[model samples]
Target: MGVCPECRAATYQMRQGKLREEDCLRCGWLAIVGADGTCRCCRAAVRLGEDPAWLRAVLERRLLPAGRPLQLALRMDGLRLKTLPLRQTRPLTTVKLPSWARGRPAELQDDPCVCVTEVPGQLGLFAPCPRSFTREHGTRIRGRTPVEWPIVLAELKAIAAERGVGETWLVHTGDGARLALASRPPTERLVSPEALVDLPQMRPTVQLVLQRAGLLARPRPRLVPGWWSKGRGSCRDCLAWTNGNDQRCRDCQMWGHTHADGPCHRCGRGLPLRDGHCRRCLLLLAETEYDLDHIALEGGDQLWFGGPYAPHLKTTTNRAGEQTGLYGRRRLQTKRRIAVQTSRATAHTVSEHLAIPGQLLLFHALRDWSRLDGRPLPALTPNAEALLADFTSHIRARGWTLPGNQASLSALKFLVAHLGADAPFHETDVRLLAHHPNFAAPRVINYLRAIGLLVPDEKSDALLATARRYADEAPAAFQDGVHRWIDVMCNAGTRPSLPLAPSTVHGYVRRARTCLNIWHTVGIDDLRAITADHITTVLDTLTGETRKTTATAVRSLFRALKREKLIFRDPTRGITLTVAIPLPKALPDERLVGALDLLPFARDKLSLTLAAVHALGVHDQRGLLLDDLDRARGRLTVRRAGRLDRTIYLDELTHQLIKKWLAERHRRWPSSTNPHLLVTARTSADDNHPKVHPRAISKPLSRIGLQPGRLRMDRILDEATHTEDPVHLIRLFGLSPITAMRYVRAAHPDRYRPLPIAP
Candidate 1:
């Protein structure tokens, strides 16, 4: 009864005129009934309008014997039936093509005698003879001559003669089409050029050809009443904006070149655009807009972009796509998605990406950012466009992909709010901004640092802040001595052979502060008052590792005070107690089993593997650089105390993981400028080569129920148990002699008995 939607073959729809029988509505395919189910033609192509009986009769006649099948095809355009068997291709019959619907009117043919061209300002859009394809698509043109060519040709020829321009250019044709387009009945869009880039009729390419040939008007600069904004203030002479608004203003106004600009086009102020049409106009517009639930941006197709700029949005519509109207609940069906269509867009098209008011405000900010900074942005996509989208719907910011994910937009917001009279501020100037809880500045700082817009920090703010916090917690009288110790420990002033790490310094002061706090509660706060008996009592209160670490901390505190002459005697002296060396236990076989396999990221897998198999410390893992991993040589160099201490070589697993992780890292952060091997979204934007934070290296391991410190110790202890020799442990792991001895002692307790148990 009808053609099948799929397969497009002619098929019966009902059986016995009572029940639906031929096949399902969707495919119209009934492969078999009882025995004969196969249909080869359906698989190859649709056979429309052919009588089933006729086709079968023809097929039987064409067969030579009880032989192979012949392939059949119909050339739709030519209405010829053809057959192919082995080698020869020949037509079998000529048939009329049948269809119920009307065919499209014939496409416009190009007329070489007529000119073709592009509309001067609109891109992708040609000077039609073009009908729009979709309300949604970008500028794309369809070019062909008009249906009423004879009349249009006569008109074009007359115009060409009058204008003294050649007939080959499309601009002239464009003029002809413009005059004739409306009168010609609405039909298929076929844009003709007088704007030929729109015909693409090239003799070949010359920009502004007709205008250059003096066939059309060329734009010239406007000369106005006050071309220069030389002076500001109400004029006493004419009681208007200009004192000279006397005669020339009237003349310019009459001619309409009127640089002789007048009062508030809205407010009657001399302002070119008084208060941008004043609060009164805004309220009036708001009153009207409030009545409607939905206002359609005519022919508006939305797109989304990512950019790094102050990201606060002034919502014309909420996230749900409802306008800010007092009445009406009408909502649009479509939602805005991050635009993946980064294929180049036009100046007009880019503005469509942002909300309307945001579009208006963002451009002004961008103009200020560009003009004030004295640096024009380079290309914007894949990076700056998105960054500043929350900032500019027009001009784009050009740089690497915005420095962060969700926080990146907010980061720019902070930077813009803090920008001074002179932009690209120093890291110190940005310090105040970074403290806001809602504002994330580090990612933007990393991006700015990469672009050479912000100066690098001399001393990282986090480090300085942490030190200051600990120093402030010291007991009042002991603060002076404590600051001195901290300064010495941080290598702030005079150089010592070795300086303690920030964590180590914190540990020392933290423990010392605990003792001081306890003593303060007991009213024996001063260092001079802390006698040996007080030290013994405090040491008695703490046990095991806590006792040992606290004793070390107290002794260091007293030693510093005595050296500084703040105390006469070191109460912690001669108060030493022997502590047992703790043995590293191997992780449970079950816990270690398949842990790496569970980690989600390649970077995490490699990080945990090095900690568990190779015994890398948290700091060591953070310090690893891209250049440190020598894949070809199967070597990984570890930096210790700013010097290369050991080269780990000889492993396939390490190499495999390194390869996988590097690939993943690069895939995720292709534009990363970080020199460090480990880069997260946080650190990838900076070229400064900041090491991955120690917590970053350990946190993932902790999340999956693993501990880097314990895992690392387990590795070393396992190695020591197998080797048994302390010297081997020292040499292989680059461990200190004392450290190796302790590990060896733990491994072979049979050789070194613990203190005899008092039975």
Candidate 2:
């Protein structure tokens, strides 16, 4: 038996000689089966070691009291016994003892008396009397109030027996009332037979009960050994073994302690080394080299690094390895160096060469020179640069008006091609050629002519020549031509001689004629006579009324010619009638009347007014007068017995006779609406009717006579013709100016005679 370390008491052992018996002989610890087959000490019971059979028998008992106060005690020989009330707050009732303890003898007298001490206030102690605690008594105790003492003791003993602690032990309180003590330590209680049989079986039942009550324990994390530590390994940095340790290794002191060799050149801290250089130092070196190269390559300078004569050098002296061949590498390196040097040199060259100051060469190259040369080249000399600058300035200042002089235009073309290949030559070049101070206008004109840039027509030749003669002494001929051409084309759209209406075509013909006349007078044979054919052809080709309406148009031409003093009638070939017609009376009857009304002319002042009224025949009396003259002529012919009668109507006929003559004559003149009469010869084919042309109506009146100027001629012919009634004369002879003037002179000879009466 093992001794209890805390109590210094010898432990009880199971007695093999007795069935289910355990006793402590030295300490006088004794327990007998009062209700269970186990020894008890100090009012508690303890089991000897039990097999499945005994444990099963022990559990089958109803151990806890039903309604009364009851107490249970468990004790071991060497350890302190534990005493607990089966019913903490209620009274205990008698319970049936297990069958395993029914035939067992009690040994309470031989065992040491365990002192019974009362706990203060509520907790009480009870003792069992073997006689009072019979089965019948147990049943009766269930109904008793405040519990029967013997039954209570028996219930407590039953609880102790069920828990496998003997009921022989007594329960008592410590002297200070702070604790309660049992005379003996507790015996080992039996675990469930179910638990001992299968832990898996018991676990699920236990877990289910606990879960239902919400008291289930959390599942512990599954740990895989060697995969991750479960409170068992050192920190990662430490190289030490940590089978079950939490701290890091002493050597490293940190979580990670992987070693690296190189330190940073700039920061002086150990850093990861790669490709023979620390990361920081490598970056620093690369940046430093880049900055150095950038600075050295900038501006107009060349620089080298990591070589002899360089300010900074990098070398590996200890390792006597073969040196890289400098030939090929140097060629590549030298090529780059040469490129940099060439670029810098080109920049400097351009700065020195170009005339314009403060202009960067590289920018000029990109903006201007590259486009000029297809790529940048060595710069121009200062002279060439000045020429270029001056040329460009001239071009910008003059614009398209720059001269096309051989030297100047050639230089401009070259410069423009160099600077702006796509720019067009402007009209300013022609203007400049015409007006430039250094060049003669003729020479410039000649050059423009040679290039087909200027063509001198009749209109432009005079101005052009004038420009040339004046040459360097005058303003630009080309500019003058531009203005003049604009005016001519813009304004010259009409002329009278043109085939179009006089109003529509007059201006054009006039301008052409003017230009032609000017050219001819100026001794320009090529321009002379150009517009003559154009005018004549235009008139000849006219196809409408101007061509077909000969009578009306001849009348207009007669008036036009008379007004212009271009009319000449000899009367040797044909009778002549000379008149000075005003512009209002110059048109044909229709137009003349329109002009008369439009002009508001008085009747007396109108020269062709009577002719208009007579031709239009608005009055009946004119037709009656002509009819009477015809009838009187017929009467005289009959009176003379078929001889032609030379005398016709009376010189001064009555109004009715004149009215009847006009009415008769009005039937002959198809258009006769005025009171007028005239004879026209009839054709054989038209024996019944007279065929008289309006123009021929006045022909016989002019020739109405015998004896070289007979009665008809003598009656109507006079130099200064006058009449008492000019209106009557207007009705007679169709009242045409030519016919009326002849009659008026014949009738009033004295008034018309030579105007010599003043002598």
Candidate 3:
């Protein structure tokens, strides 16, 4: 009890609505009451019927910031409103179920009725209700009939929704008529209740509850077009004219045929698809995968269908402006066509020796054949054809061997394959060639350009900029000094001058570039700044012949600089040559013979011949003609470099092997017009001779661990150790006296057993 301001005592009873006064029980003093239900003594009003916004505002103002929940609960008279702070009230969960519940079932006489609190409805808001009726306070409620479960559930749901509570579960208690109303939804529901009940119409309600419990899956709707059952007419939603009364546009329904992940790649049926293929297209996709697998397996061996060699077609025209085909261009094309056809036929043959992996690469190449035509090539000018003709004439005039002719033609073929026939050459083609793995070597590029096939592109950074860097970075005085030395060495007239070969000159230039780099590194780019110390650093860093070459190049550079008065002393003055006699590196006799015996005809014919000739003490092998071989005398007249020729007597083994090779060669190339003893497998020019490529001959020897130079040395050593007479050495192996002395000096002193004097 509290006291009012005027009265000393106050009543605790509250009254509202029309009643304005309350008498104090103790003193009988009347207290004034406001319509808002505020106590006159305490000046406090009941929280009932307060505006939701005002309540929220007051809560936000009074409550500490950390204590505020995302949703604030305002307990009004008839409604517990969940609201945002300082905002209006709105329900969070809106679960709207159809009103399909029927009347409640009657209680059974056989089963005892379970007493339960009556579930309240709309009146429960303002008035007190049974504990069972309030889902928030009670745990269980009982009903007599299971058939009435749907109706009871409907009522419970409505009550829960009105009170702003979450889900409630209806669990069977197994008692006569008792059911449990859980505060939260059950994870698993009991289906035995439905099994015992015989209510056909209420089965759906049971299903609904089971669905909420997640014990049963929701029903799937039938996938049918809405317009199928309706008559054909224009759609109201979209203004497009329709074949049927379809409301959706055709594009919308195109992929909506099924409820699966996506449309089937083949039949437009919605699906879970793979490789963009449906069941209908699966076979095609599988076949493609099989082919690719086989192709990849074959490609792993580094062989492809259009490989071994990429094909090219060449055509020749006569003076009458018509293709005369006299140059055998047509014949060559026919041969290539036959070869391709034969390869494809073999691929399809499916022989036991030729597996699927071997042929599948060819099949892949066939697939890509059509696209290869459009591949970009190096561009050339109209004068390129004339230049090529003139170049070929020049090569012939120089008396290059048949192999040299073939090599030049092969390089030209590579050029024509990328740049189409009639395409003019450009400097860009040189840069492009630099990127090629096989032809990109600096030396190779120099050869191609020297032969007039490639021209330098001044604008390109690759070759031109590199050339410029070498030129512009070197001081004019230094480059002039280097070039003057180069010219003196290249000149044949000067006394004490060793005329440099073209390759030697190139090597000197390359070496000078290295010395320039070292000079630049030491911050001395000028010729006058060059010291013996810088030259020594550059030479010391190099080893073997490279060091010797660099030292020589620098020595020449310093000598020229000194003569021009650019330096007071020679930078190369301290450099000295330490010449060491090279010991003969001859292969062991047994290993050499064993390697020769191991050589099979199918492996290589050129290597067999090369090894045999080496064993016969024939060092020179250039331009050896069929006439040069005297098979009757077991002898071969070999042409050495610089027109030095000699006839060497071949042993029985070498002679018989040479005869066998000649027979094999005839059998293999019956139509060959070449007169050279060893000729190229294919021809490029109209010349009658096409010698075997040096690379072709060298490949087998390299594989068999036999070096020609070493084999030649072994033959010379065998002869040198046999006799001390220089005449016998020179006559047997065709060596000069000075050359014989080197072999004699290398031989053991005991091996030089002189013949008994006049015995």
In terms of lDDT, the best-performing candidate is 1
- Candidate 2's TM-score: 0.13
Residue 10 miss distance in model 2 (angstroms): 93
lDDT tens per residue, model 1, 1-759: 332232223222121111122321112343311111113333232244333443363454331111123234544665543211211222243422222111212443333323334343434332224332111111111235344544445555565577678745445345434332322223323322333333222212222333333333233354343434345433331223333424323322332341233454444544222234422232333333333334323454112121221111221567887645322222211111112122222221222122222122322221122222422212333333444563332112323444334455554643443332123545654554455555556655656665556766577546545655676886686676678767766665344535676667778887877777778788865678889988898889989999999898878778766765778888877886977755677788898888988889888888888888888888788878888878878888888885438778847887888899888877777767677878876677554667778888789888878999999889899998887688887767778888897888788889887658612
Which regions in candidate 3 have their CA more than 4 angstroms from the true location? 1-477, 492-498, 559-570, 602-619, 670-675, 680-694, 750-759
Q: Which run of 10 residues does model 2 get worst, by summed lDDT?
A: 172-181
Worst ten-residue run, lDDT, model 3?
63-72
lDDT of 2 by residue, 1-759 (tens): 321121212222122111222332112223321223223332233232223333343355333321221124443567755422222222232444443333223421221222233343433233211111112211222222221234334444454456565423312100101011111112212122222112212234333333333333355364454434456653332123443354543333321233355664544555444344543234334334434345433333332221122221122223566422212233334555666667665574432222233333353121222233333334445544554465445434432244443455443333333333222222333344334343333323333343433435234434434423332332232233222322333343232331223332233322333333344454445311233333343345444544333222223323333333333531112312233332111222332333323422221112122223222221221222333345444421112223332232333223243444345444443442222243332221121233335334333223321111122233233312444665565444334565565455545656766546322
The positional error of residue 637 in candidate 3, measured at the CA in angstroms, is 2.4
lDDT of 3 by residue, 243-263 (tens): 344554353344234223556
For every candidate structure, what is the RMSD over all alpha carbons to the true structure, in angstroms? 19.8, 48.2, 31.6
Ranking by TM-score: 1, 3, 2
Better of 1 and 2 by TM-score: 1
Using TM-score as the measure, the top candidate is 1
Stronger candidate by lDDT (2 vs 3): 3
Better of 2 and 3 by TM-score: 3
Alpha-carbon TM-score of each model against the true structure: 0.49, 0.13, 0.38
Q: C-alpha displacement of 157 in model 2, angstroms?
A: 99
